[model samples]
Target: MALPTLISAAQLHEILEQNDLVILDSRFYLTDLQKGRQQYELGHIPGALFVDLHHQLAGDETEQTGRHPLPEPSELADTLMNLGIDSQTQVVVYDDMGGAMAARAWWMLVQQGIEVFVLDGGFPTWQRAGYAIEAGCNQATVAEQRLTISYPWLVSEDDVVANLETERFQLLDARAADRFQGENETMDPVAGHIPGAVNRPFMQNLNEHGLMKAPSLLLEEWTSLLQDIEKPIVYYCGSGVTACHNVLAMNYAGLEAKHVYVGSWSQWAKRILRKIDEANA
Candidate 1:
């Protein structure tokens, strides 16, 4: 049987010595991009390679694009090959932020039809378990074969707008409740959400101890929110990062939604604000 979408630290420890396993340290901060690498150099899981969220997971940003846009499929495939990832590799990704950033890599890889899992409880859990840690970078030799990405899992901004107009799908925002309610405006110029999006903060997927909730529990929570709505559900976050966390959780709970808004709230808000500015000008 294949491994589930989420892997425990114990399961990872058991397979840590396996040659086919590839662990990635995805520790990242939205405000401080270098903090993740700095922390990785201080200490990380043994044999784990560091993946910078900004450089590797995201693409160049512009006023029209979200803060952390999805990288070009071809570019990301090349990067994965350079990192020694191949078709047969079993990839495990983790971050300090309760799988927020790590889930992005997991989602991207899974979208490419690659088998990958997010480390449940993240790096803090491994530390709590007294697992061995390594310092400095561990670069893998570039692999000869490159991976291909087929983004059947992603939804474009146009899809979001159509969903809003047609109500053909449910739109879920994974941002914090306050942010969703437009209470605290910091990340983007606009305060509110994409008009009809329901706020289901991604952090709610985790327990108070920061580990993911049981699949049964998650199923109940999500099912209730979804209710009788039979349309395909779409999820988004500030810049499409944490939204993957919700997608991972839903998949673990057996309620997988393949459509994710890659540009998310940041791009949506920007476009709305720009249109308003243009209209006034």
Candidate 2:
């Protein structure tokens, strides 16, 4: 059987010595692009490789692709191969910011049917538990591999536009209330969210300890939002990063939110501006 989607720090510590295990530290700060690598060099879980959200997980920023577009499939595949992560390697990803950043790696791997896990509560939880921590960069033995990849859970910007008219998917925004409400606008040019999308901040998935809420509680909360709505659910957030957190939470609670708008609001807002400019021209 495949490993569960989430693993506690203690559970991960037990499997630390497994030959097939590959731990990835995806810690990132949206404001400071290089901070993730700096933190990784300072300290990280033993045998872990650092993956920068900007360079590794995301592709070049373009007018059409948004701030943090999904990396080309081959790009990530090559990175994994260089990390010696072949088909048999089991992956575990964690971040300092709860599971917000780590969930990005987890989502990408899971979509390819790879048996990967997000460290419950992430790196902070592991540190709190007094686990072994290593400093400096850890290198992997590179191996030759060509992985077959697919994004079954991804939805394109065009699909989101179409949903505005059809309502086939119940769109949810994973950004905070302030951002969703068009206040304190900073990241993107325009404010607010795509039409028909409701706010469901990703932080709601965590508790006072910054750990995930119990499965029952998660299910109960999701049930209230989904009551009698049969439409398939989709999630999006600024730059398509934190959105994965909500997706992970829903999946952990035994609910399916298989569709993610990878371009998310950053792309949507930019495209809206281009359209307005064209009309004014």
Candidate 3:
């Protein structure tokens, strides 16, 4: 059977030579946004195009939207074409901070009904494994803008509010333990996590090197946190970025869930009427 939701370094090396494969470098830092591109210029997977995590993954900020909102589907479709991505292209996305940022790119592509895979360990793993790395910018022929509206699998704040008491789902918070516990709310004005939500930091899916652990290992870790798989799993993080990593990890474990809370903590905390940290506490 084929590897699930993951692409190996060797496999990636082979695909790098293929015309249908599109490699995207998604390395980014919230504090230092330009660092990702700088690293890409230093060295990257051959033919890999740099996808700015802040610009490409998120929508424009508005009074109603969160810090990293999902962009308009048509706009994103245009971005995919510019990046040389198509329905049949085998996309491989990776980043430095575990797979959080990279998974955001992965999820965005999937929202367009394009099945793209995450690099299991990201660029470092590929380099450590002695895989070939090319320096400077790499470019490919931008694919024709051939995008079709598929399913909108993203969940909004309204959906979360309505399903608060429903037994049909579980809201999984991928934020850090401190943020979840309300001890540390440095990022947002409102401290603590959503009501009735459980904390499951996205980094738990990977090791120190930012690579995903074995599928069996991830299965055990996630199953322990969530006792039942029948219940629908909805994930959220600071701004819907890292949460996608958890979703992608779960998909790798053969437990693909539905409707991730894309707005995540950023949007969730903006509500004053709704209970914030107390519900889940």
lDDT of 1 by residue, 119-174 (tens): 99899999999999989899887877898766787888888878767988888899
Tens-digit per-residue lDDT, 1-281, candidate 2: 23247899999999999998999999999989999999999999999999888998889999788788888888988887887777777899999878999988888888776778999988889999999899999988785666876787889999998888889998889999999999998888999989888888999999988888998999999999878778888889998889999988988888776678989999999889989999999
- For each candidate in the order shown, give its overall lDDT on alpha carbons: 0.88, 0.88, 0.80
TM-score: model 2 vs. ground truth: 0.97
TM-score head-to-head 1 vs 3, winner: 1
Candidate 2 lDDT trough over 10 residues, lowest sum: 1-10
List model 3 lDDT by residue over 1-281, tens digit each.
22337787888887677878888999988888799999999999888899987887778876566789877777777788888888888888887666778888887787666768888788878888898888899776888756864437788878888987675678899888999998768877788888888888887888776778777998888888888546788889888888888888887876665568887877777774245444666
TM-score versus the correct structure, for each prediction = 0.97, 0.97, 0.91
